[model samples]
Target chain A: MVNEQGYNVALVGATGAVGHKMLETLERKKFPIKQLTLLSSSRSAGKKINFKGEEYTVQEATPESFEGIQIALFSAGGSVSKSLAHEAVARGAVVIDNTSAFRMDENVPLVVPEVNEEDIAKHNGIIANPNCSTIQMVAALKPIQAKFGMSRVIVSTYQAVSGAGNLAIDELKDQSQAFLNGEDMEANLLPVSGDKKHYPIAFNALPQIDVFQENGYTYEEMKMINETKKIMHAPGLPVAATCVRLPFFTSHAESVYVEVADENVTVKDIQSALVNADGIILEDDPSTQTYPTPLSASGKSEVFVGRVRKDLDNAKGFHLWVVSDNLLKGAAWNSVQIAESLIKNNWL
Target chain B: MVNEQGYNVALVGATGAVGHKMLETLERKKFPIKQLTLLSSSRSAGKKINFKGEEYTVQEATPESFEGIQIALFSAGGSVSKSLAHEAVARGAVVIDNTSAFRMDENVPLVVPEVNEEDIAKHNGIIANPNCSTIQMVAALKPIQAKFGMSRVIVSTYQAVSGAGNLAIDELKDQSQAFLNGEDMEANLLPVSGDKKHYPIAFNALPQIDVFQENGYTYEEMKMINETKKIMHAPGLPVAATCVRLPFFTSHAESVYVEVADENVTVKDIQSALVNADGIILEDDPSTQTYPTPLSASGKSEVFVGRVRKDLDNAKGFHLWVVSDNLLKGAAWNSVQIAESLIKNNWL
Candidate 1:
């Protein structure tokens, strides 16, 4: 698979936060490509990106943006991906979408490669990236699910502002400064910027991350609920997420409580599985005060897991604290990994 | 009862983080203090602290230090509290100890007055201040517990580094600066100051807040677990906690999941209970993106409660976020309130 001929790769929305990381991941992972095309919105069309020390000019993405591209990576907002992803797919490109646009489409494979690489082969051109919160949970849970058969997942996330895009990061910084200076903070871009009210995140927690869906779960919440079922291949999995935006600028951290079918699985067994799992770094030495945090996971590509232990009274239940950089493994790198997978499997 | 003749108050660890706040709380609340004695490890002796602009010199804490001290407030490290608390108690001083040393001591009442004021009468001259994480949680859950019996509690905290002490706060600033400049960081405090290794908290989370306990729960976790039972007076209640230290300088936030004994207790009902609970402020309104945050709770006496919502599948379960300045409500003010309680209840 590593010796396979490289496919022609293209990056759509190549100038955004996750988009920039996509470039970094592609280069860092040594994702092969005979040729590369950079595409973005009209406003950023003329921007040039330097990858592997080669400058590439960005062109406005349209229906024809995928002309010779064999594989396309998308991290644009949902709207852009929804409008142009099909166009890229129609142009003979296997599109790996890093948006919620088509995750629950039922036609797409929601992949975290490590959790479900085989599912990626079933993709009908467009593969979806699971929610950042969901990605970390699944990456950490897949090993357990494979060995122990998990039944239910209850995750309450302390998500960073980066998952909302770069604007939220700026807002956090600006508001934090205002707070320290005794000035009135303008919370224009947090807890759903379009939502009527804004709460300060400098030292606050916003329960709602994205807009609420019809089922009362916020769009961010629904993504985790639906995507977990798709990635784990358990359609009826009872998954509940309470996602809150904290003051951090990067990395989404989760406190996941899971009920496993195997009651005999001890904490040592869970620790071994997590430590052996791909893309997971277990930092759970309680004696050394070792565990994950958003600040430490920032810019790292692996899902940092810690605080793994058995529930106090429940024999079949366990708890874990998982953290990962939303920009890297959550979106950009995961999207790029899918592109690399398609090339390795000769699907591109 | 509040129309009180003042009580004699002694502040142990008179020059530390919580000690300073205790002074502010006493002055701000105008706690009925007829006499004040300042005690610390002999090092802080001779140091002068001003309360309401009145000068008080710190004294060495020994058995003789509590000669006439009535209500003694202890926030020096656990060792100091452990050694001198019983000494003070022998001198007829009711010691409100802000340390982990006596929290689990069966005879010592772990009190959060709003939640378990009646438990105070059972104290054997030694009262324990719950962990900062547990303090805010019990404050928010007290009203909920009153309206509906709480069956189980699962909490993950986004705690401020200040909860570790004043030194960790300075370390955060220094490390953050070092990190921003692409420089290596030195850690003298954090996670656990006495631990062998120190990781940078510039953008990292250390799952350990204190020493590891025998049950595999960190001292911080055990504190939350045991203190919850003591404060809520629910011996049979199930409680679990994963305490995380964040980069924030002040305020500790928690994502708490609770399964109530009562059925169908709606989010609105929980909100209504928190709306008027003493030392609580309800700020949960999803449509308006309103919720409680640490910044808003900072500098305020009341714990801020928000993100109150019913669980999707479990009708009897609910989730709530609680935030408060760890120094204020969690330690200093709570200790001061204990002093006020002594005067109000005529216990001194």
Candidate 2:
């Protein structure tokens, strides 16, 4: 199905949440695609999806599925990426993975287009998109890092259920309705689906996001800490995160505390740095109560930064509220942007 | 109606959210109330409430209402407290004001019974109950400060709508139902009802909890910062707060970062400090996914501390997740505890 006008692209996990957003982002961005092959797990195969006024059948993804593909966007899961990303890469496709499988891989480049677009060129057949929480934090941090040298970061996240995937969104909806009705809210997919316990995410806050590591930090917290340094290329940055899942459905909001190396950086300087940044929208104005909330930034691709304030005690420290749609700039659009960069720069 | 046994008590704002909780707490704690006077604004007057199988009608509060009141508990708005608190004190009633009207007053002692119970003795006719978010944090931090010698604190709050009182809670319920039913979520009160703009708290997070100060920090954020210092009696403590309102109905959860003066403290040391602390329940065990969440901590009078971890980069720093019922330990119980302390210590 390869055509002469554009590159043939294969989208893995086309039936899932991030995958669905990827398709919409590609269609909205008018991504140059000659042949679009939708791939999913065996369970979701044969489903019909319409894109750009054309119906396409989702096929089961195997090694052979990437035969003539020029670009593959993998978001099925970490295990799927581990098994098939290399198969796709070896068969002559640049893989932009949307899982944690290759994010910390020494050879793979962890990329956020707004933070580290040039890292896309250094990929050895595969590029890794950072975690949803990490992506938005770095997008906001990069502008500040560029304007003033950064030192430390401490973030506490108010994350949405959608970052956990489609089931979590359904669970939040079901549980919320159940809670409103004075019924016992059933919990099967929250805090972590694979973890030993399940807690209600409706009208509650779960401090644990992913499974806990040996150091007592959740994998989601570690992802935010590790991937932030990797994408920003600040290996020694002292980043700490406490990831808490709130009942919201879409956008993830982080209360970030950063200490810049420059002691003279004021609130205005931080606001000015974010105002003209590529994919950042500075919505901070205390006088007007202008700031981004989950509902306000749900469908937006740009990272919204607001509530900028200098630390009362530390001259070099500043606090910011950063929010972005986890599915858009955090995952799907970032993946597609990496693909666009690959083609535009002839990195493929 | 005055009796010979126990102190004569006046309950202001008896029809409001915190006021209702205060009644329950007084009844549950078996506080020695010889006579109870229910008072509210003119709008809420004429309402009836039951206590210990007795029905009492609320009256409009005036200076005369506190004629024989030995102790007055105030949970009304700040304007009401500002107008009537002095009048109650002038009538020989020791006022325990839950509003922010006198929290920063140099003459008024800001007391968190667990942290600064002795400060209640220094009250000049009025004792200020610290903010809900501040009460839980200082309750968790006091033990750490006692054992480890605290230095700096940074907190990001996951606050509930109940902190805004009854109307805000109703807004959340109505808006959440509307959002689920695919109708428009109306917003009349949230992120400070008195503020110019109103944001929906249904399935959303609002970073502003109170009116913005000139320094760009919300009044709630400033309350956390300044009130924590006063309650902990550490005025020089470098405290910063980002107070965010979430969709939950009770229990304010805080992600706190603190640096102890002792650099060699381990996670166990921090756990040990919290394990035996008064009014604190340590619920940290990452292996079993044990942590304190808003729902788990809701309706509890004790502050729940969990997810305790040593900072990877800072030898002297630690992080904690703290949660408590905003109406109980954060408001009603704390006020009642102060009254009990006053009675026990003969401070009144």
User: Using DockQ as the measure, which candidate wins?
Assistant: 2
lDDT of 2 at B248: 90
**lDDT of each residue in B211-230, candidate 1, tens digit only:** 88766678888888888887
TM-score for each candidate, following the candidate numbering: 0.94, 0.98
- How far off is residue A248 in model 2, in Å? 0.4
Expressed as tens digits, the lDDT of each residue in B199-271 for candidate 2 is 8999999999989999999889999999988888888999999999999999999999999998889999999
* Two-chain complex of model 1, DockQ on C-alpha atoms against the true structure: 0.43
Off by more than 4 A, model 1: A1-5, A169-188, A191-193, A196-206, A212-217, A295-299, B1-5
Q: lDDT score of model 2? A: 0.94
Best by lDDT: 2
Alpha-carbon error at B122 in model 2, in Å? 1.3
Candidates in order: C-alpha RMSD to true structure = 2.5, 1.8
**Clashing residue pairs for model 2:** none
Candidate 1: lDDT of A123? 80
